[model samples]
Target: MTISVERAFGLLRIVCEADRPPRFSDIVGISGLPKSTVNRLLATLGDQGLVRFDVEDKCYRPGFGLLSLAAGTWAGLDIRRAAADEMAAMLAELGETVHLAVLDGDEIIYLDKLESAQSIRLFSAVGKRGPVYCTGIGKAILAELDEAQREAIIAGLAPRPYTAHTLTSPETLRAELEAIHRRGCAYDMEEHEEGIRCVAVAIRNFRGEPIAGLSVTSTASRLAGTRMTDEIRPRILAAGRRISAALGHLPTPC
Candidate 1:
């Protein structure tokens, strides 16, 4: 491996991990990079617009260039169209909301949503987004990532609590993702919204990476206990499998 390249990326990661703009001293301490090297790389990064230095706080934050790059990547995905038929079927059969989402940095962006026929139903806007450590679709995508990739994303997440049940600690969220991977599923136990609960499964690409996830959402009163296991979980998995197959993905043999 290229040592200098790795160190430069490590410094960048340190800045990204900070909840707010990071000072030079903080980057040096967290990255364990020599002060001189860190200073040089930061200057180069600033010139390239990968980071911007704030004069008032004497700290660095992610720059607009990074956001533009990320936007380009998210724009190219065809997740909404790919899962359209399956989502409609699930919504009709279960009479519950069906959601399709894909990871975007440390969050999951809702590509599409099929609302339930019931009067009491969850309604997530098509372009809505949620924390990767909290929502069912978010955790489903996170669970399918490689350990190194997932850890890198987790390092930058703030883990703020949206509800009483949110996993606000890194260790707990890490454990949760690991369990979801083993079980081939994830659950949102009112982690994002107080009245909502969901069951989700990852949607893999041809390469077997979870490019997206699908969820069946309902009121906590409807899905909070055995009803989820007895009803929602199986249907959600079946829908996810069909979508994955359409995307040219086949699960590997255990």
Candidate 2:
């Protein structure tokens, strides 16, 4: 039974990896299987909807059943679990705080956090609620929403100033969100806490909907100038892509 299953999967892999749909002879040639066995496996695969016989092209191709299976797997992925390695890597590299958060209406709730090694760190905990307009992860998630949804969310908020650098004007916040979306990242330059700053990116799901955010947090002085641009931004953005990819979000073509 195990050998039978392995042979079936081997045939499936040949079909799936082919640049073009392959004929029965092609499968038999590539798999080195006898004609009778290849025919039987192909017929069984077609019955299961794992492969389909194309009449016009006279070749075998992958079936929609594969998509259904893939969708189910992607949907079941836990965001925190998907992001765990990337978060730990960021903490190790920068010795700064790393955060994972999800949008909760007009705010963001921390899903997980890795505290900085330094004694002076941002005061936050898992499940803590934060303002959407001022924090890095919050703005990253907000920037991924559609214009109508973004506008509605902003209109509903009071937009109070959280610190000296926080932008209270809706017009300015909207402009910043637009910039964040365009650049594929967001920032909190002492906008939330007086000395804290961060860079963040949105994590999307299989449907291309932004479901969560990942960020790197540190003191403003530590994240300034060259370090922010060369090291931090690239790392956080890469982490976002890794997590989003794990959730089955395809990258938009450049």
Candidate 3:
């Protein structure tokens, strides 16, 4: 079938902007397209496994095919392979879940995860995607975006509360991202999921754009009262720096 690339991209934008799965009617409403046209497009997307319709909820969400493509892309990235050992060593030393993620549109997609030896660990799948405004790794990568780009991306998001701690307001999230840029690190203070805390730093390539991030996630109870900056932050930053170096980034003293 000959699909219009423009129409396909338009549908993709609608899906990516949604906070949760969107109802068929909602997509039609948002796109201002005819019901028959929308249905045809959705049917095509479904056949490709890029989107799945939930009969019970009557909503459409991203499907496994998108994840499979993402995984294949990640597998081909030399940076991910080069940093795998370092990520594993860091996870082993800290006894916390370590993640390597890259930005996909307005979200962060986990490319790799190193499970900790500890009995208690945050359960995160390798191909899982999370909102940039709520995750440490996402925020770390977002810190590299310029103000205009950041605003454009934030404007496109339909923020929904994932947890009580999730930042739902764009104003507040923008302020937090600004701080992350200045500090060179970002924190997830139970923003995406309750009981989870994380610290992340950006991995930049030779062009100085953040292409990925490295993060450590653990329960809030474990991180509480501990000097994270004095101890954990350095380690996380080191890992990020190492990945950046492997990606051809040369550090200039700040």
How high is each candidate's TM-score? 0.67, 0.76, 0.67
**How many residue pairs clash in model 3?**
0
lDDT of 1 by residue, 1-254 (tens): 59877877787777777897789999988888789999999887778787889999999998777888767764554667778888888888888888888899998888888788777645477787788889999999998899899999989988888899999999999899888988778989999998999999999876788999999988998786697877887888888887887776787788
lDDT of 3 by residue, 1-254 (tens): 35465676687678867998899889999888889989988888889988889999999888778989877765565877867988888877888888899899899999998877766646567898888889998888887887787788899989888889898898898889889888789999998888888999989877778888888888888777764677788888888888888776888888
Task: Identify the leading candidate in terms of TM-score.
Answer: 2
Prediction 1 global C-alpha lDDT: 0.85
Clashing pairs in 1: none
Ranking by TM-score: 2, 1, 3
Candidate 2: minimum summed lDDT over ten consecutive residues — where? Answer: 116-125
What lDDT score belongs to each candidate, Candidate 1 first? 0.85, 0.91, 0.84
| Residue 224, candidate 1: C-alpha displacement in angstroms | 3.2
**What TM-score does candidate 1 reach?**
0.67
